[model samples]
Target: MARKTIITCAVTGNLTTRDQHPGLPATPEEIAQACLDAADAGAAIAHIHVRDPETAKPSMDIGLYERVVELIREKNTDLILNLTTGPGGRFVPSDEDPAVAGPGTTIMPPEKRVEHVARIRPEICTLDFNTMNSGAQVVINTPRNVKIMAEIIRDNGVKPELELFDTGDIVMANDFLAAGHVEGPAMCSLVTGVKYGLPCTPDAMAMASRMLLAGTEWTGFGIGRFAFPMLVQSWLLGGHVRIGMEDTVYLGKGQLTAGNGELTARAREFIERLGGEIATTGEARQMLGLAQ
Candidate 1:
């Protein structure tokens, strides 16, 4: 029997906007529709991040999250929901003073960061495990805050999709698991190709994968041009994969992707061609021990 590979479609990250990619889902309706399309295209999970309907900036508004979750559940109940807690971690230093936070910094207390997850009670939600310089601003998730965030998510009975950017992030995630802040078998996304973090090089990914705890359900993705390539690499190395506009705007050199569905469809092809089969939602749920 072929090993089943799980494909997670990160429909929209908080970074890109309508100006950068017009197809990036912004409003709740658009994001909900995008997840539906991804499910139709064979994604087992739809990793989501909501934006302001009017402005399209990342938002922590519980109302927006509720609507989006309501929409997705109302339409397709099988698709796994993975809400993001990554938006509230930005910290930009004052270029002038360098002591105080500069403009464009959005830092929330750990509980506030995962407030929607506690309320909406999704099957999975991202818990970013590291702080790194993401080129635009400093991504800050301190150890103390992460412990708090992990405890909250676990209490809510939502799985933390351990978002790891580098080698050390895996250790911290393991600590969370050991401390029982993260319950049961954990999942991780080995993020690469970001500035100041691990690049999309094969060795970097291999090292990061090796760092993960045994039996941890893990996925890997590289932003920009390395996105699809990392999908292939991750599947080949005995793991699942993630794709969509959140990780890359372009499908190829000059080809703009149609939407999250398009990326999801191609990712299925990559996994199948690698001699692996994509997991259905039910099988994925069993593998991850998600609540039915």
Candidate 2:
């Protein structure tokens, strides 16, 4: 029997991918509209990451986040909001010192990392478990930083979707669970195809899936070209799916994606053809233990 699958659309990520995909949402209105479209298409949840309007770079500004949330709520009240707390941790080393923060680094206090989560109190947010070589720069999220951010999210009644890129990240998540920082039936997301993290293979996905607790709920996403394949593989393994231009630029080999709604539609079609039903927002909220 096929289990229920939930489709999540990560509207716009923190990176600058507008040059690669012309339909990437860069402003608050565009981002909110993208979420509404994804929800209308079949996405139970919309994972959002706001970018600076001028530069289209990642931002942790509470105002920008608030505007996006408000816009989405005013338009579509049923779509689950999953904000990104994975920004503000980029640490690019300097060319001169080679040890200090480089030109691209956007490091900040851990509290500032989830400052928007505190103020907005979204239904869900992400917590990157491993900080490793992400291409040329290092993404730093120390244990102390995670503890502080986790405490804030928990206290504010927001759920942290712990992101695990590699197997080592599973250990970190287990530590948090053991420490009682996160609530029961832990929520997690396994990201693959990053430059230095785990590969997007069925074996790797299955290994990480087994590591999750019995009652734990998890989602899987792959970056760049690995997006669709991982979506199918994740559903095959009884996990939920997330996809958007945030993880890929192309709808096909050379075809640039039109929008996040396109990705969500394709994923929904694939899951339904496989005899699985797309979980609704209410079903997803119950499955993930989120208050509807």
Candidate 3:
């Protein structure tokens, strides 16, 4: 039998705005409902990022995260939660004083980055394993900082899903595994197509996949136009898949994606037609060694 493909829907991301897609969930209720809809439509895991309700900007506030998690659990969905520790890493240098951080910077200590993860104790949480320039600003997650964050996640019994933007990230993830910061049977996400990271191409995806630690359970994703293509490549490459408006706003060239559920249903079609069965929440937990 072909390996089960675990479809992970990234409900929202840090940088995307309402102008890009009004349907992008901003409030806790909307985000929770989006995760449920994705689960009902076929996603086994929901990768989440919360927003500041008033400004619609990404936030690290524990209150917002609590509300989203509470609502999702109260609804009693089967989706495995994968909260992000990716916020509090932005670093935009000031034009006047390059030595100082710009007004956009939100760099926080390791404690703040993993605060929500510790409080909510999700089944899985993202740990961005490398620091790279993202658009105009730099996302800083040094080895020291990452180690601290990983330790917190591990201690909480929450598996850390390593977010790899390039080969260097894979190297760091391996180091984390070997040093015993991250738990065994590593889980990683091949984050391709960032302007400063690996290009969104088959060769790039394959190369990054090849660099995964032995026995690593991994998935792959791309942004915007590259999203679906990466999903196809990810499944073809013997990994899993993730899709949603967080990664792309369009279902087709000109057509906008309706919601996370719609994108997830489309991903299920590709996996089933390719002879790969979609994994259930239970199966995904087993594959990733997530707790019962």
Model 2 clashing residue pairs (backbone): 92-102
Q: Relative to the unseen true structure, what is the Cα RMSD of model 3?
A: 1.0
Q: Give a tens-digit lDDT track for model 1, residues 230-257.
A: 8898887888999988988787888999
**Across residues 258-288, which tens digit of lDDT does each residue of candidate 2 receive?**
7888889998998899888999999999899
Q: Candidate 2 at residue 20, lDDT?
A: 76
The top-ranked prediction according to lDDT is 3
Worst 10 residues of 3 by lDDT: 73-82
- How many backbone clashes are present in model 2? 1
lDDT of 1 at 161: 92
Steric clashes per prediction? 0, 1, 0
lDDT of each: 0.89, 0.88, 0.90
**Native-vs-model 3 lDDT?**
0.90
Per-model RMSD to reference: 1.2, 1.3, 1.0
Report how far residue 94 has shifted in candidate 3, in Å.
0.8
The TM-score measured for candidate 1 stands at: 0.97
Give the clash count for model 1. 0
TM-scores for all predictions: 0.97, 0.97, 0.98
- Per-residue lDDT tens digits for candidate 3, residues 153-221, read 989989889999989989888987888888789989999889979899999999999988789999998
